[model samples]
Target: MSISATEGVGPSLWGLGATTSAKTQQDKDMFLQLLVAQLRYQDPMNPTDSSQFLAQSAQFTSLEKMEEVAAQTAAMVQAQLAFGASSLVGTTVTYATGPAGDDGSPAPTATGVVDGVTFGSQGPVLSIDGTDVALAALHTVTRPGIGPDAGTAAATPADD
Candidate 1:
């Protein structure tokens, strides 16, 4: 009789944890538990191959490193968003008011200089003329004193 390393493990092993850091720790713990159980219950007459164990260990290490890189990348992206939002503090921005009218009219828009930025779970919200506007709603950014055509900077949506 033989039991594979992943004989009973299923899709539940890939379920997400509460946070990136917490998820990584949880994954390591679960992997270790499975490895220990495999070692303890193996048939003595047909011992599991040592090379198989080594391969599993190497795969676990690779997964851990990949998780660390993902966490670092998320942090870097957040920092970039903060810096970009801050740079817009004094620039005029034209933003959509809402969806287009049901009568086929274009969507209403409002323009204002961004006065402040507030970070939330959804990303940065710009305070434009005292109104809170999502970064995605912005259409164009223009320097305060420049003409509309010459100063218009294309708006880019933030990644969700």
Candidate 2:
């Protein structure tokens, strides 16, 4: 006998009306939990057939994998945040090389922390105690608290 078309794919036991909002990460978890409970209490005589059960199991597994990937992404973002944070420590910068600082004297280097992040991925601005400058706009970086050595790199010319 052909199984009913409604078999195994009908409204969930939680009685949520058919809505498209049930596809987000949180909803995926809830649906997996509900599917688990459904399997646990299904009638034995007409056991949830292997094919149907396996399909639902696959859905849950895929959802779990997506969650893992999301978690890894979050961790990578955190690590980048930490790296960006440490970039500001002792960065002995002289903002006196760009078109803005054309006289050739290094701008006053400031010692400070990454007060905040403004643009995304374009790099953050470094706030040295009292100086505010974009990391991208940095003229040169040296030891945490020392200006770039004029002897080793002053006349090398900007990288081609």
Candidate 3:
């Protein structure tokens, strides 16, 4: 069935008036519907300017491309975090821990080999010596023999 914009029927079919703002895909579709209806029912003697229609179409295309770029940037950030974490595997990392004394004091450090990496709500977390350490918590990365117990022989957990 044909529709007319001036009959109040177009708003009901589109769920939103053409004059309303659109922020999402559904809203964009409704906006497009309203625009189409307006074009179809516009006064034939005073038709909309072709340039105006072209401008609106250009704006919509720009908005769509911006959304695509945002999505791709987010994916790229996640991939970078994953790659950085993965590279830490088998390497010893030292991270800050609480004070060595009961009273507030200088922070101590713990060292361990990264066993695995996993994503958490905040960001990537590294599995170090059976403990999950946030990436931000790491203070330094060094060879296995360079930390606090550099010369002490310790049993490897994997050997147990």
Candidate 4:
């Protein structure tokens, strides 16, 4: 009988240890444990290379650093969006309403004062005339005094 790597052999106890499903820090610890076990139980006649262990450790470190950078970048972008959206308060904006179908018809637009800015799961959403409009739905944004029709005053502060 031939035993394979997946057969829970000494090293298989750790598995490949790389998976998208294992997102938590505990998963990383388990993977590290597997690596250490593999090194400890390696055949004495053909010991594992120190350089290989170093490379794997470096790779894991790099992955962690990259994930941190990505998280920071996402936070920065969200901050920028919040700042930009807040500036829209008291300003007039024309935004598309409802889904735009494939009929090539002109999308209906509504103009109102930006009551407040809120964050949704996807990104920034604006409160326009008591409606939640996505930032992407905006067609135009104009200062209150610059346009022929000034923006309507916001009725009240937005709900949390």
Candidate 2 structure quality by residue, lDDT tens digits, 6-83: 345534643334432446534655675677678778998988888988888787667656666776797687678657
Q: Give the winner by TM-score: 3 or 4.
A: 4
TM-score result, candidate 2: 0.40
List TM-scores for all candidates, in order: 0.72, 0.40, 0.62, 0.70
Instruction: Rank candidates by lDDT, best first.
Output: 1, 4, 3, 2
The 10 consecutive residues of candidate 4 with the worst lDDT sum are 11-20
Model 2 weakest 10-residue run by lDDT:
13-22
Per residue, candidate 4 scores C-alpha lDDT tens digits across 72-103 of 79889999998999899988899999777689
Off by over 4 Å in 4: 1-27, 120-122, 147-160
Between 1 and 2, whose TM-score is larger?
Answer: 1
Ranked by TM-score, top first = 1, 4, 3, 2
Better of 1 and 3 by TM-score: 1
Best by lDDT: 1
- lDDT values for all models: 0.84, 0.58, 0.77, 0.78
Which candidate, 2 or 3, would have the higher TM-score against the true structure?
3
lDDT of 3 at 38: 75
**Over the full model, what C-alpha lDDT does candidate 4 score relative to the true structure?**
0.78
Given candidate 4, what's the lDDT at residue 49? 92
Which residue pairs come into collision in candidate 4? Answer: none
Those runs of model 3 whose alpha carbons end farther than 4 Å from true positions after fitting are 3-23, 96-109, 120-122, 144-160
Q: Pick the TM-score winner.
A: 1
Candidate 1: C-alpha RMSD after superposition: 11.1
* lDDT score for residue 35 of model 3: 79
